[model samples]
Target: MKTLYKNYINTFKGLSDEIWWLALITFINRAGTMVIPFLSLYLKEDLNFSVSQVGWIMSAFGLGSVVGSWIGGKLTDKIGYYKVMVRSLLATGVLFIALQFLNTFVSLCIGIFIVMMVADAFRPAIFVALNTYSKPENKIRSLTLIRLAINLGFSAGPAIGGMIITGLGYAGLFWVDGITCVLAALVMIKVLNPKKAKVLDELKNDNPVSVYKDHAFLVFFIAMVLFGIVFLQYFSSITIYYKDVHLLSEFEIGLILGMNGFVIFIFEMPLIKWLERTAFTKLWLVFFGAVLTGISFLILNFTSWSGILIIGMLLVTFGEMVAFPFSNAFAIERAKKGNQGEYMALYSISFSVAHIFGHNAGLQLSAGIGFENTWYIITGLAFICAVLLFSLNRRLNNLKKIQL
Candidate 1:
């Protein structure tokens, strides 16, 4: 037990103080993320929108994210990540509050689009900041550390969010979410003073290769989009599935979702640390993670018992712990070869694109064919994504050998 405890503690030994502060900021922001998880339910239950309408609004959110990520990437390269991060957070906070007032379909779509555009700009900027703050060797672990903060906050957020929804109603969620975004920005300004922090030099090329022309990366981009599509359902269609199919309450649904975060918080860092020491390549780990995610959804079709929900969530959580940090590290490493901001932005864009397709597709499929069929379709997509990643891994290995 002592040896196990010491090993877990050792996983956190080398990250910089700035990285810790970044993680704290992420925690503050994400802990208040009560809205997104329950947004579909809000539209359906409170606003009386159809599943199709809710899907379109979610798609608009994705469209905004793509635009935001592009603009953020360009701005990060020109003006610096610090300015982008602070402004994005502040603007997003205000937008969240404003978002509460929109009731009609068109208005909510536009409102959410605007809010997400401002909000997602933070994604690539933060990635660039991570590059600045962390040593190359510790990058994946640093990503995992930040993810741990996100999950820790997420674990707390949903339970609290559920209570707020029950006691104060959905409007309360908007107010709290907005306030937290503002608070996180303030914390970032106070602690992560860009001028005072040490900046690592990224790979320098006088004539850097454009990310657009990187064919291998483009394949990986496609795979990421597929992965995002399969994974994002947990936030959208799956919540409704829990509520409608299993007859679970909002708070119960929140607890199940919160469990995903709690599991990651306890185990992900140590898992990543151990995996890093093994001979298995990062891409191989990602492929395995994808397979596990597929299985998580596939198993849902086999059982009607609510206990199955817990088991499914556990499987997906472990898959996420294995997949996301390494995938992020891979993107960061590839970005080193070209324009870092652009590469990372495209990386973020893949998810945005997935958002454009994933949520709507999941909801529509579930509404039309039923949740069982939707799970089967999602399972198939996940496996396809795994196959794509495996191919990408082989290609990368071949390229490395050629370079040698």
Candidate 2:
């Protein structure tokens, strides 16, 4: 046991200093996000909003994400990732704590939406930071580790937040998240302060937005946006579905989500390697991912709590694990040098865009028809996304590689 412990420390020591930094940042960001899954419940049960009203409010962050993605990337290029990240963290911490005080639904929505804008700003900043700081040869490994850290946080967040919500109510969850956000920023500040974290003047002639023109890149990115539309069942719709339809407790809901993170921790590295060894390039895998994800939703429509739901979520996690890093990797690979931040920002658009599409659509469909019907609609969107992704794979295959 002593030998094993020392070896574990030594192995961690061998990792790039940046991995530690990323892990800290991700832990902080994800832990902060713990409150999100519970917020819909809070809106309905605590704040007295109808389900439709909750959807309208929840989608606000999606709008904010679009702006955050563009601006955050630019800021990363201009001011440096560490500075921007630290600032975003500090601001968001305050915003979340403020949420504990808001009683009105509209006020609560605006405050939470603003916090999401700041929180998502970290998306572009940190992606650029990691991609910039790590050596090119280690890019895939570094990204995989980053995802692992985030999943670890995801794994912890839901379980802990669920307990807090169950015991202490929604306000307690918000406070816990608020404290973690500040703590995470502190760990980041103390653990790693790369030179890039230093102050810098803006790059006036920066042309980061040119990412829009890359056809193949656009296709994958667009597929991500469409994929996100359906993924909200995990965070938004599913919580309600589980509570209302299945009559699950907060702890049980956390267990359902925790399963995804646990799988990611155990399997992500092997999955990434398998994806590389075969002709399963990111593009093809993401296309297949969409189909799997869509099928997973269909499974949910038929069965809510059974072996099937577990299997469905497993498939959803499998698709997500495959597609997310692919989106990041491909966007960075296809981008021009010196403008990686911009490309990643464009990539953030998918996640951000998906929030709007997924949540609002969930609201309308769930309200107009029913939750099961909403799954059918989202599953169709997922299938359409897969088709689009397939077309993109072919396009990239046919195109001559630009020698950037």
Candidate 3:
């Protein structure tokens, strides 16, 4: 028993202290991520906004994310990660507080945009910080650790936010979220001291790599965007399909969605560790993961059994577990030391685009065609992406092996 326990403990050993602190910061911030998860509901219930209005407001958030990502990458290359992290967190916290006062549609749209622009900027800074603090070999595990914290916090956030919404209302949600962001910023300031680090000084002197010129990375990025558009259907379309087609209640759909995070929390770290020891390359894992994701959605067309939905969720969760960390690692590997921020920023544009394309396209297609047909479309797309990403990964790997 002791031997087994030691083996488990060894799986998580060797990450730097900075990575641990960053995990804590991520946990704290994400645990307060109640606003976005419930934004549409709050708009509809409290402010009496129409569905279309709520969607437009949500799109504003996605647009803000694109702008934020671009700026965050640019600034991280200039001023360094610590300053960007602190400023973005504090600024976002203030914006969240301001959001409660903006009741009109136009005002709410502007508020959401500004709030997300500040908040989403945190993503690139996080990748830069991780790459800055961690060793090359430890990069995947380090990224996975932070993702674990995020999933854990997300599991807690919506449940806690539900109670907050029930008791203190939407205003209370904003207040709690804002306070947490400010606290996270304070913790970041205390933990990370830029002036003391020589490595950061060196990075500060290096030139930023332009993602636009990297045609190979651009291909990988496009593949990710395609995969994201399908994978993200779990967020936008899966529950609607559950509610409408399967006739599941809201509570059941929430439970199924909750299951995705729970599975990732339990499985992701250990799986990544195991993969690190194996001969299977990251590209192969990603290819198979995409294939599995397609199969998960395709399964729905064959059966109406609710039990099958759980299986589909598990499959998709595992696919996410396999693909996302390596995708980040691959992007990081392609970047030079000082250019991590730019690569991650450009990489993150995939998610931003997925937000607009995935949700809107998935829903519209489901409405226009049928739910089963929608899944088939996503299934086909996932396969196409898997093939494209696999071929691209091979080509990039050969070229970069000599350069790296």
Off by over 4 Å in 2: 1-15, 196-209, 401-404
lDDT of 2 by residue, 192-285 (tens): 6775342221223345447767666777777888888877667888788778887888888888888888898777766675576687777888
lDDT of 3 at 285: 83
Model 3 whole-model lDDT (C-alpha atoms): 0.80
Q: How many residue pairs clash in each candidate?
A: 0, 0, 0
Total backbone collisions, model 2: 0
Report lDDT (CA) for all predictions: 0.92, 0.77, 0.80
Shift in Å, residue 189, candidate 1: 0.9
Clashes of 3: 0
In lDDT terms, how accurate is model 1? 0.92
Candidate with more favorable, higher lDDT: 1 or 2: 1
Winner on lDDT (2 vs 3): 3
TM-score of each: 0.98, 0.90, 0.89
Pairs with backbone N, CA or C atoms under 3 Å apart (clashes), candidate 2: none
Tens digits of per-residue lDDT, candidate 3, 1-404, equal: 79967776777898888888899999899888866666765776689976556656767777787788888888887787888999999998888888999999999878887888888888898898888888777889999999988878777776677677767888998998899899999998887676653232124425655778888788888788888888877765676677667887544555676677777887788889999899877777878788888889999988888899999988888988898888888887777733777888988877777665776677667767878898999999998899888898688678789898
Sorted on TM-score, best first, the list reads 1, 2, 3
Which 10 consecutive residues of model 1 have the lowest summed lDDT? 197-206
